[model samples]
Target: MQNTDAKVIDVALKYGYQSVDAFSVAFKRMHGIPPAEAKKQGLKLTFYCRLHFALKIEGVDRMDYTIIEREPFTVVGIRRTTPYGGGTWAIVKSNGNNVTAEKFFGRFYDLGLCFGFGQDGSNDYMCAVEYDGETIEGFDSFTYPAAKWMKFEAKGSVTENVLGSVWQRINNEFLPQSKYKKSDLPTIEKYVSWDEAADICNVEIWIPAILK
Candidate 1:
């Protein structure tokens, strides 16, 4: 929204957004308001742009992650279908604030695992527990084939910044420079621990990956 000589779409393109809709969504997510509203209210936006978008500089903090291979496994729990990149995953707040989340976590004492499936659109989500050959009457099962994965850490009590940046950092920082490429498998989220009173939880993002 800064260049007077450029169309909105042109500005979006220049900044690397494929389309204005994606740009606006990102803008709204970052600023807590739609770009149109900010523009209408005359809100001047400023950002800290890194040089060449690189951190080749020494002493740059590294993201926390690990590479591991896992055998075939299955998760059993509640499942829901939602549009890809919709409010389901877009939530910047704790899963504690969600009704579905409340039920999913509350009912299961086992370590929580969320499985997300999609390509370009249509997300199938399952909030479940690791299956041990026992059937969960009210729940369903989602099985994952054996694969290697990149595991990312999402720390802190606030889900918005920590969890949200997991995807961004993985895509922009890790994948771009690594010898690993994403594989065709569902993205898995493991809830390591949750402190309801403190609203603190350890979340792990696992993306199926293959080495180049």
Candidate 2:
């Protein structure tokens, strides 16, 4: 691990952080220590490296997905401009009273039609469902262009962050080994269930890709 202060600053800037202090706070939350302390201690850190799809059997977990071309569609729902990492869901949770807000978001997840864009952290995170092209109050509408997509599905305990874990595997493990490359488009997250009280549920992550 390169623990140089210069390297720390470089990484902070590369990740869109405004300052070392901001990056250090996020780093400490993730790695349990300040960046300076981490460097001083020379601790080993795991990195989620960029994936390049190739032919090989590596990940033990099975990743099942299918390629499908869909026509343009529009969705309407509440949207929040989050900073693209942790606490992104706080906005959704803060909408209504505790139970009401939970149910409001849960309804969308239960319908298995919720969609998200802006995974790149450069845009707002929109939580919405397919809707007519009509304007709706208190909600924003977005149109998804027609394109090819790879949809991976997983079912497991929500407490385990199943969706997030599988997404990491797909991006870091599967994409790097496959014959396809990601496209410059927003990825989609299709929730099969959003039962906060449930032990398990289903979810899907969709990535826009093209054959390399």
Best by the TM-score measure? 2
Model 2, span 1-116: residue lDDT tens: 13234677888899899998999889887666677665442243334434435796444445555666778887666555555442335555565423442454444422122234
Candidate 2 residue pairs in backbone clash? 52-176, 53-175, 53-176, 53-177, 53-178, 54-176, 54-177, 54-178
Which 10 consecutive positions of candidate 1 have the poorest summed lDDT? 41-50
TM-score of 1: 0.56
Return the lDDT, model 2, position 143. Answer: 77
**Model 2 worst lDDT run, 10 consecutive residues:** 108-117
Off by over 4 Å in 1: 1-59, 83-122, 195-199
lDDT of 2: 0.62
- CA RMSD for every model? 17.0, 18.0
Give every collision pair in model 1: none
- Measured by C-alpha RMSD in angstroms, how accurate is candidate 2? 18.0
